[model samples]
Target chain A: MLSLFATDFIENSLMKFIQTSGLMAIFSEGGYKYVIMICISLLLLYLAIKHKFEPLLLLPIAFGMLLTNLPGANMFHAELFAGGHVHWDIFVGKAGLIDYLYLGVKLGIYPCLIFVGVGAMTDFGPLIANPKSFLLGAAAQLGIFLTFIGAIALGFTPAEAASIGIIGGADGPTSIFLTSKLAPDLLGPIAIAAYSYMALVPVIQPPIMRALTTKKERMIKMSQLRQVSKTEKIIFPLVITIIISLLLPDAAPLIGCLMLGNLMKECGVVDRLSKTVQNELMNIVVIFLGISVGATATAASFLNPRTLGILALGIIAFGCGTAGGVLLAKFMNLFLKDGKKINPLIGSAGVSAVPMAARVSQTVGQKDNPSNFLLMHAMGPNVAGVVGSAVAAGILLCMLG
Target chain B: MTLFVIDYPLPWSNILLIALFGIAIVFVVLVVLVYIMRLFGYVFTRKHKVTNTKAPLAISEEEVVAIVTALRLYNSALHDKESDMLTINRITRMYSPWNSKIHGLTQMPEHHNK
Candidate 1:
């Protein structure tokens, strides 16, 4: 009798342990999907580590995806944020590590903070020197609107379409800000697409740039820009923040934060604050933002036809954006006089990848004419692309939010 | 700020309208910025020009040159004459256990016989 009781106790304990193990959950019904999601995450990890494709964000994002997909770990709960509204009643009981971090994204705080860092690091001297670059910046947004129509035609809702179209902006934080507001469901795919394409700016932009412009147009050397004064530099961020915020109040958070950062940098009064924002604050927010955004890519959300469609449409949007900038620049040359004729090559930099896009313009131009240096000229449109995309995001929010 | 809210899918016409109007607004806003920046540039440049005109140098070019040359000569005269030589001096110091090679090396096992 004693031996039987001991045997029974041991058997029950073993059964309970086996039943509760995460490994067992993986082998249960409907478990293959989790395996697939995990595999995808691992693939992204490989890409991030080996290729260095936006590694800072992608690595954390990939790890978050891995954590959330571990069947029984329960690090993230999508139902808590179901239907694009946080279920605060159950949030405290059901929330996990990622849910807490995701609030920064849902509350529209992380992206704006990231923008402040970007602003501090940016030098607006180029854009201020050549205001016409604003036109090219506006022109690059053609991809965004065009993709909006395409996504709608392909059967996404207007809000979802807007979120997907923002990938063309080539501004990652702006993409996240718009998507988190307009369609939180699609945030994972849209962010991955935006960053991946941004990393590929050098690869993707050059072919389109080469195809669009003739050798002569590529070789066209722009005259040097006038020296921008310290006063103009200080006044620029203030004026831009006020004008853009007042015009489209929807853009206030992003534009205001960005301008504040630029002010901190240009004013030279708060060097420590500028350094902290540019380095420490930016790094912390990026880690949190990346992980939370990546955690959203569950099997149900990511392993679908829509993800495939977003990836396809995203590249199309990027291509169209590149073509738009180049074409607009060529068109502008028709009106611009001889010395003032703009190089169509610099137009491709209007996609807002910042110094990367500008560098591509320089590289392609140098290939055609060794003497040509389009980096500074390209920077004008590149920075303008940042403002242009913010305006586009604001417009989309007003129309479709 | 939302113009309209649609629970149902939007029609093709509305989609097109949003696209067209969105692009148009972006252009209009940026164009306004272009004009404003241009005006700002004009104002600042005009201020610089006025400052330049108002601040004509009191000293003539010849006088300035003469002053600079005399200052250069006086500065040269302040230095005492020395032999034109370049030398790297070596200084010796007493050894300390902190930096001595014997202290840095591991001690070898001592041979013992019983």
Candidate 2:
């Protein structure tokens, strides 16, 4: 009788352990999809670590993907944020670590915060020096609107299409801000696509830039930008904030935060605050934003034809954006006289990848005319692209949200 | 809140219209910003030019040059003439217990063989 009781206890304990193991869950129904997602995450990690492809954000994103897809780990719960609404009542009881962190993304806080950091680090002097760069910046947004049409034609709903199209903005925070608002389900893919394409800016933009402009256009050397005054710099943020907010109320959060950071940096009185936003706050928010956004890429959401479609449309958006900037520059040259003629190559920098796209313009121009320097000139459109993208995002939110 | 209450998979016409409107709005806002910035530049540049033109010259160029030259000559006169020679000087110090090398060194003791 004693032996039998001991044997029964042992048998029940073993069964429970086997039933609860994550390995068992992996072997269960529809388990291969998780395997594939894990593999994809690993590949991203390899790319980030080995090739240094936007590793600051990509590393955390890949780790989050790995964590969330682990069977039975329960680090993230999709049901909590299903139907594009947060189930606040059950959130506390059922939410995991990532689900809690994800609120930053869901409530549209992280991206705006990141914008504050980007603003603090940015020098609006370039954009201010050459206000005409605003035109090139506006031209690049052609990608966002054009991609919207393409995504919709591919059968995505308007909201989904809008989120997907934002990848062309080439601004990750803006893409996340817009995506999290419009199509929360597609956040993972859109963010991955946006950042990935931004990392590949040098690779993707050059071919299109080469095709659009002639050798003469590439060799055109722009005159130096005017020296912007301190007083003008101080007034810029205030005027832009008021004007943009009044014009597109939806854009207030992003543009407001951005201008506030810039003001802190330019005003010369808040060095501590500016430094904090640019470094510490930026790093903390980036970690939370990356992980939560990555957690959204469950096997179900990521392993689909839609993901493939997003990747395809994302490249198209970038191509159109680059072409738009280059083409508009060429068109503007028709009005500009000899000394003032714009270099079409610099127009491609209007896609807002910051210094990277601008550097590409400089490099390609240098190859054509080794004496030419386009970095500073290209920066005008580069910074303008940031504002242009923010405005475009606001419009999308107004029309589609 | 969204301004439009459109159905999913919007009609082709509406999609095209939205695209056009969106791009137009972006361009309009940026163009407006460009003009405002240009205005700011114009006003500031004009103010700078006015400030320059309004300020009277304190002295003529020749007079300014003459003053600078005189100041330079006076400053040069203030410095004493130096002999163009570099020399090494040697000094000897009185010996003290603190300065003695023998006192500073620790000497090893010799052991007599048994």
Candidate 3:
């Protein structure tokens, strides 16, 4: 009886040892790739915190990548969720928090919701006052189509090429929406490229803006925008929704939510709801969207030649888009009367990076002439680019989806 | 899975078609929106101008008197010290590195000196 009791004690101790060492064993099994991926995640986090490069999205994305890659964490498994497919059986287990959240991205709900928030926050007065800005906005999408051909030349599938090309639009939500639909496997690289370029707009745009336009063009000042009345503001979203929805039904979800948010803001009675959508709702969706997108970048998936290709193409796309807008503005200037000519710097704001792109225009314009106030003028094209990109996205979805 | 696979020979016809159609559609739709917006602007501004021109003649002397009386009564109902207090404060623009604190980090050096 004493010998049997001692055997039982020894067996129990062995079981405890195996259970405790399971975590350490994962490192040996996961190999050097995990180390590289973890370092990359840390690099992203450093960029976010230290340099303040899109800290709102990048910080959460970096942290999510870190949490996911930790040995034995099992928070998210990218291999199982490949090609925009989610396996519910595995997702129902203990490691399904990110998988469930990622469903919002997969179904394109998060981006559409984000559009609602953006619309609520945006002021369309400038765009309404200067309707001609829409042409510049449309011209900026030249990069998207041009990149589509370029992606095709690089041997990407048409759907995949469409997804790759939209990174040129420099609209993060639109990029994610199109990529999630057309090329789910490419979502991770495409998203990283899109957000990274967007954050670098100040660095990227100024050079192109200067190269394309002469100092005289940059310093050209325009007449003040006509005052847009409340009635025009209220009708603007409704008219846009009806026309765009009828023309491109695939855009209804994104454009519809945007118009609804704008209507809520302009209707004058739903200020509380508009405020909530602008702040709380936007923050919530951004958190889920960023983290889940980050989790998709597992070591096996991210460290590849295709990701390098995407990074290269992304910069080219942004440059092309900026150049396209600038060139179009220059072309338009050739025809317009003296009083109506535009400062070509406002053209680069046509990439739809919102206030950042607009701010770059103001900064660059002010460099040439300190008295030039280009913020409101730049905003016209900035908001117009948002609509233009959405319409472009709809065209892609209709043809490719 | 798509017909335009990466390995497939370049379908230049299809690619060009897509590019042209996409750009054309965007241009056409936006151009249409421009006309609509212009029309809306014209109609609304015309109505507004007409109303402004007609508004003065439509208001009788009695209505003007009633409006002034009501405004006076509403002003009297306010706190005594707050009534007729129109403060025009000048905003002095100071160019300081600390004023560019978008993220609210790094306090003004003046504060440290204090």
Candidate 4:
């Protein structure tokens, strides 16, 4: 009688409240391996907090990871890809509320939405002020190419190579954008690699930046930007959208969505929409995205050697892109009229890591010579890098998929 | 009967699909990279420059490059300084509070306070 009572305590209606009927049925394969991934996420969270890496994102991601791992913790049913996001017990075959939240991430909705916020917050003024920084953006993409080659050599198919190579760009939305459309199954690892590398931007970019530039080059100071007209500022996004749309129709969805958000902000007439996209929309999407993405990390899928390789290669891709951008800048300097000296350190800003790459450029420049500041100037290339990588991703999708 | 229940290893078709997915991502990253490089190259080689920090209010090539570097940070788009004031960040020298706008621009180390 006492044993029966203990069993009842272990399995009671109270447990039913926490876990939905749908979760009670399914046989979760690879029990122990799954636990390891949960541990990995815990480690990442601890490292993020302890080392003070991107705490804002890492902490949330860690929490999401933790919630996803506990048995019957159906906070979100994790079938976000199918549109019905509710926690469900596979055993009893009943879905719950947790699945609803997973819908946003599984469908690859959140990152794109965050882009709207990013688009709103972005200022193309510096790029317009200088316009030349776009080259650095192009240069930063060099790592993607080198990484692609490496991925292929490592036995990744052309498609796998492209996905892995994109981690070099350091833009999470684009990574999710491509992975979701191309390889839904690999989304979990790819997303993990992209965000992990993005959080590690400062650590990953500096050595390559310093190795490529001399103290003299780091000390190079640029002139101020010319005043841009409002009309010109307004026309810029429109012109880019038109040209890119014509160039890569397949890339239209990703580029179109990104530019549409940017256009709303730059046009200056849609202040309300831009504000919504930047604040409320971005916040809601980030929460859903973090949780859904965490659910995909089932141990069976995430524990492959390929995942490890992708992570390692991601670092290389980022470094090479930074080096590529800086080297290109230095090469350009040779042809540039006497006073035009491009700071190779700013070349690191060529990666699509956005503000982080720009910050790295500024920090490195300031450290070498406090008098030297490269933040605003790096914008020209940083935003340009974003556009460049998008076009590249679009073209690849067209050719391969 | 046992043979019918045997586990089928994950397929090459799945792997192929996975590889195709990767290609899409790299392509985007590269296109973005090249476009940025070209855009900056155009700005760097612009016909007229406004002022170089070395010389007040006059745009020199060095100043052009330096300003481009400074302006690049604007790429982050979190310009709390002018960001608070206007979405359009451009202002003519006459409108600036200081006639020596470029003079103290890099001086005083404003970001140092942060």
Task: Point out the higher-scoring one by TM-score: 1 or 3.
Answer: 1
Off by over 4 Å in 1: A1-6, B1-8, B80-114
Poorest 10 consecutive residues of model 2 chain A by lDDT?
A153-162
Clashing pairs in model 1?
A: none
Between prediction 1 and prediction 3, which has the larger DockQ?
A: 1
* Per-residue lDDT of model 1, residues A113-207, tens digit only: 99999999999998999999999999999999999999888878999999999899999999999999999989888988998899899999999
Per-candidate TM vs. native? 0.92, 0.91, 0.85, 0.71
Question: Which tens-of-lDDT digit does each residue in B1-114 have in candidate 1?
Answer: 432233448777888999999999999999999999999989988998998876547667788789999999999889788989989899887899988878898779677897
Candidates 1 onward: DockQ, in order: 0.35, 0.33, 0.29, 0.05
TM-score attained by model 3: 0.85
What fraction of the true interface contacts does model 2 reproduce?
Answer: 0.71
- Error in Å for residue B50 of model 2: 2.5
Compose the digit string of candidate 2's lDDT tens values, residues A33-137.
889999999999999999998998998999899999998889999999999889999999999999999999999999999999999988889888889999999
What is candidate 4's lDDT per residue for A1-401, written digit by digit as tens? 99999899878867975455433433355556646767888897887789866666666666776666666655644343433223334513644444565555545577667777777777877877765676677667777767877776666666667777878877887877776666665667787788888878898888888887888888889876666656656666676677677767766666666767787887889999988998888877877776666666665557777777787888888888888888988988888875667777777887877798899999999997998888988887888778777766776667555
User: What is the Cα-based TM-score of model 1?
Assistant: 0.92
Q: Rank the candidates by lDDT, best first.
A: 2, 1, 3, 4
lDDT of 4 by residue, B1-114 (tens): 221222323354654444344444544444463465356445644523433443555566788898898888888776555444546678656555566756657765666665
When summed lDDT is taken over every stretch of 10 residues in candidate 1 chain A, the lowest stretch is A67-76
Work out the iRMS of candidate 1.
5.8
Give per-residue CA lDDT, model 3, range B1-114, as digits (tens).
432235844479988899889988988989999899888888988998999889889998799999999999999898755567688999987977667665457455455554
Report the lDDT tens digits of candidate 3 across residue range A47-70.
989999888888878877777777
